[model samples]
Target: MPYLLPPPRAAQPQRLLAPTVTHLARLLLTHAPAIPPLLTAILPSSPSLLTPLLSHLLLSHSPPLPALSLFRRLLELPHFPVPESALPVLLRLLARSRRYAHHSFQLLESLPSTHPHLLSVPALSVIISTALCASAPGASFAAAVSCFESAAAVWARAGRSFGAAELNALLRVFCARGRVAEARALFHRYCDAYPPDTRTFNTLLLGFKEAGHAQALDLFYHDAVLRGFVPDAVSYCVRMDAYCKKGKFLDALQLLDEMRKRENCKPTLQVFTTLIYGAGIVRDAARARRLFDEMEQSGVTPDRGAHNALMGAYVRARDLQSGMALMSEMEQKSFGLDDVTYNTMLCEFQRAGDLEGIWKIYTKMTGSGFMPRTRTTMLLMKVFCENGRPDLGLELWDYLIGKGCVPHRHALDVLVTGLCCRDVVGEAYRCFRELVEMGMAPTERAFRVLEGFLKKKREFGKIDEIRQMMKAIQLEEHQAEEEAA
Candidate 1:
């Protein structure tokens, strides 16, 4: 027939992959009914034009509306080279929705030709900050490296001409995640182009501590100031924290003194509290008290943090009398006791087999409506288990789950471990199942504990069940890792 005959060569048009503009417009109307009229006016409803009309409109539209992200996807669907002009708007949209940001980044990199203009500075800043901050939950320190690598690829491809703000944003992400070596290398390489600011230096100082290289922090700080980046109060506080983390309390105190002597560099509460924490670790309650007094003298009233630190010090020194006295003083100041206060007291009492003290503290904590954190709950679990009160420990576990408090894997492991040791297989298996349902795979220790009990009982069927459950967890985790990567 005439239709069966091949279409005339002159009338033949190329096959199109991208949905037609009419189809895309219908989608916009269906999915995004509240799309701006301005956008509607711009997007022509032409069927022949296969590329989405919204892709072109993205360049001109600057609204923060959610509809813009759909255009980013439409533009990338047919592997179209996105206009350099639209990068900023797309990035701002991407910042609000990380899923789109990730897809756009992936698509942009996949396109054969690289456009330097497409990697705008503001976009890169938002990309670096959001990517790192939205990093996978429970990601270890190594994940920080992968996150920086991803951002760095974007920077490198964009001709690496990012502005100071973008570089600072990337540096902050690096420092936040303990990638000190990477942050320092990046700083040294790019600092000359966009000279590091005081905030940049402060972030790097914190990074050294987080990276367990506090020994290098002092030298880095001295070199930074000598390079004409004057230290601010926050800078001093960061350095003080580094020294405190390194167990150099005297050095921290000396740094505090130096900061105080400097014009307009008064140590903040965090600075004093960091030193107090150091003093607590060294059992130097006297020094913690001195720092506390100095904090008040500096016109920064001691907050609950300051009280917490000193009280922690007393507990460390086994001077419960002094710690209790401080608690009384804290009450007078209307500074309510926190979980750490109760946890520290409970742990010590647990060690001493003081059941009465533990009971009193538990009663008070529950009575005051203080929602205990995972640590508080874990400490309580351990205490109850060690004191031959497995029933209470199991009840507490159930109570936390009933309260919608998803325990950490390690915390669940603690319960499993305790129960398994007591040959309480049924209860331990219940906790294991609960953790599985909560999407948390138990620790190897937890598994080993359960396996030991199951094997001793020669219950190969349950053993097989444990293996199957573990396989499911491993498969799910592997899928998640693939998705994250």
Candidate 2:
């Protein structure tokens, strides 16, 4: 009987102790002036514990009082190095409050000098994005641009290289808002400071592609390759999609082959998906089918997006049988359909005015445990109204609301307008009032439709009440815009 060696004990990885928010909150609230020494004493080995500790306080749904109090206390400790991870969340929280918004900007402007480590790309992006979303039209752009320059200046002083990521973030913001020209100008202005990298060119390429600047996109791609920045899959995708948008499907396919032959650049799923979507837009079902098959042969297993894009092509080309067959195949693969899948089918049904098909898709969608989103709600309401079934539309609205779909003002507007069109004014008024009670105001067009119906029906009382409500809503919105700015 040979003695068996005991199995070697498995090594246990060290686990981080969870920060107790309650204890920290009590300390901050009770010993406001002594946070620094107390934190140092408690977290002697890990000052970074304050990171997750502050994150919990800031991100909680509880009233902002505790978080604000903690933040003020932490800010008072000039030597405390606020974690990079916490700054973005803290800025977002402060940006949401009218009084604290200025403090957030002040902190952003001062962070690189005051705490350079906390001036992360994500933190700057959050501040820039928040400023860009401000309600006052051009003022928002001005603020965003100002913040961008200020960050650049502060970062330069902190001996930090404001690199490609920070530049790309700002570029994305401008491009996303359809400010491609401005984004290009920004690229030019910063190229000297942050030498243009592959991602820099890719960002501009996508910006130009989205803005429909075909000539600029072409020129930029050539310039990038000439400048020794080898175009990656993304670069190829942007150029391919640009060609597709210009109705040059053959050229796009040729480029796809070109990328496949390259050393490191291989055709990605996006590459295939882009071609399929382009084919869909042109109603070229044959091309889409070929691309889908080629994608699988190339070892890029099709995801939901690829399947949906193929389906879109089939339906657009009036090949309903092929579309249904493809959908069945997707189900057979066991990945199951998602919101986009259902929505794609619904869009086709709606476009064809096939109310029966729409209902079938809706049934399947719900049977799969899918909840209706705003888009789904809008489509159903529109189709129902078009089919002279405002009653069903109203019922659908109630059902969706019951299922916790927050009332979408646009969808409500569609239902109300439909009701008014079909002379179901009383029901429309009731729905409008319900929306008001739910703290949403429908579109002005819906209001006008309701008002017109009331006037014809000699319901001056309801009209007067609605007018007053509209005035109050408008005033509230104006004040909110001011605060947001």
How do the residues 143-234 of candidate 1 rate in per-residue lDDT, one tens digit apiece?
44455456566666655654566667777767877878878887887778776667788878888878878668778878877878788878
For every candidate in turn, the CA RMSD to the true structure comes to: 18.3, 13.6
* Clash list (residue pairs), candidate 2: none
Candidate 2 wrong stretches, greater than 4 Å: 1-142, 151-162, 334-339, 420-427, 451-468, 481-485
lDDT of each: 0.66, 0.74
Candidate 2 per-residue lDDT, tens place, 112-167, comes to 55677877888888778777875378587678878888888888888787878898
For candidate 1, what is the lDDT? Answer: 0.66
